[model samples]
Target: MTSHADQPNVARTLTGQSGGEIPRDDWSAGRGRLFLLLVAPSVLLLVLLNAYPVFYAALQSVRNGTLISPGEFVGLSNFAKVLQSPDFWHSVRFTAIFTVSGVAGSWLIGMALALLLRAGVYGGGTVKVLLLLPWVVPIVVSSMAWNWLVATPDSPMPTLARMLGFETPLFLADPLLAAITVCVFKVWCSFPFMMLIMSAALSGIDRSVYEAASIDGATGWQRLRYITLPLTARTTYISWILMTIFCVNDFPTIYLLTAGGPIDATTSLIVLAYRLVFQNFQTGPGVAIALMMTAAMVVVSLILFRQIRKSGGPA
Candidate 1:
């Protein structure tokens, strides 16, 4: 007699497959196969379009020429030069300032707007719709609009400043001011995305949680502190990370606004890379800078991910 451990269920024998077992109760197996089948095309496209170009840029960073003209294999020379070059360092510094400022500004303003709008006060929907307008506008159109608005002599902000008795500050002319200008514009243009994300996350939160807190003698601030924020922290962290990356990579607005500026003052890494690749035709250094930017962003993202995970949450 066969051991019970070796015997197949009686249901298997009815199918006329001797000693065969039914499939394990792993629900994900079939779904996983189907998911891979569905995602294969997208994965292939991503590899071809994004991954391939990134790898190609990394490869090109080592050599010293354009696609049309072959040059010497300089190994790490391009990266070293990029790191040490004054212009590249300036760009890196500007990029860091812009990224940090823009991310903080966007998150702060967006979170405020999200919280206010979530209170369902008067005109909340209208305010949300208006806030979304910036995000819906094309970047080029928005860039041009900002350029016309601020860079022009007769723009609103300057006019208002003059009217208020303060000397009209040339927003785009000064390097420090230009950086602040870019940060403000970036925040204005980007906050809608954060607001939307925060709104969704806020909506998913259970009202019962707040009610439960209220019944326990929790004040409004107490409810927000203990219950609302912790539950929403993960989404907020993700929003901040995404905004940081976008701020790091933002180009069109700054490019169109200042073209890296009155004296390369406004140039960040992206603009610097553009100047290298297109203006100066230095493909190797350009690719090196791009790779550096990508690596930095990856590191920041990893740090945030680890922190979020350590907070006993999934991000």
Candidate 2:
């Protein structure tokens, strides 16, 4: 019963409500298909590149096998042997020390640097650039530089100490000092990343919060302690988790500088695994150690992720 004029009006109404000639429902179907197409390749690639290798390694770790030797279904025997080894124990101890010290140092230094940069102080840009330089440089190059600086007998640090009328402290000679040196260098190399992340997080804060705090006579330290720090908790937590993983797995700095020596004093879990796998050709224990380290990192990451989610957040 509708006339041509009424038909045109009905068509215009439908188009107006839909926001275009195409219906919103139709647009959604097309967008969904496009998204699926875009994501499919990445999903497949991840499965092939990451998931497969992980499951394969897990399978290999359970069985007595090698790239060169025949396989046997040993089933946790390797894990048992690794748990009892003295070298493994030493590596674990070193790893704990390294993870704790390195991560803590990185967190503190990063926070300090971020705060300094945020303060609009003089030379802030220059300092940030210089700090970032270490992180950008290749790990091998940084480790080499550290090695030269800490070399025995007439090294730069020692010479500087002597010039300042202080006795030369052997950096890599004493085991304790050597470990400390590694931790310090790692902190220097790592803090920049933390600084960068924390700075970004700081930028996202509501400026009004700070203004209000100031109007209420909140001191600088009080503002930072209560407002800024709490707001930055997520970023700080993430930095801690990442730094811990990296510290635990880091081999280049420890290997190049101290080689975990001075009687295995600086040796870490990753370094010990590298030595076993490559140096001694003990593939079994080496693989086992690597797997254990990986498992630890995974567990820690999962815990952190859960905590983040539970706090009404996502990372």
Tell me the lDDT of model 2 at 313.
64
Q: lDDT by residue for model 1 over 1-315, one digit each (tens)?
A: 677865665423333256554454443476689999999999999889988887778788999998577577999999999988999888888888888888888777877788888787788888789999888999889888877777755888788889999888788887777878887888888889988988898898888888888888999889778887788888877887898888888888788778888798889999999988888889999999999888899999999888789767775
Residue-level lDDT tens digits of model 2 in 213-263: 999999999999999888887887888888888899898878888888889
Scored by lDDT, model 2 comes in at 0.84
N/CA/C clash count, model 1: 0
Per-residue lDDT, model 2, residue 54, is: 78
State the C-alpha lDDT per candidate.
0.84, 0.84
* Candidate 1 residue-wise lDDT at 175: 72
- Model 1 TM: 0.86
Question: In model 2, what are the clashing residue pairs, if there are any?
Answer: none
What are the root-mean-square deviations of the candidates from the true structure over C-alphas? 3.9, 4.1
Query: Which runs in model 1 stand beyond 4 Å of their true positions?
Result: 1-45
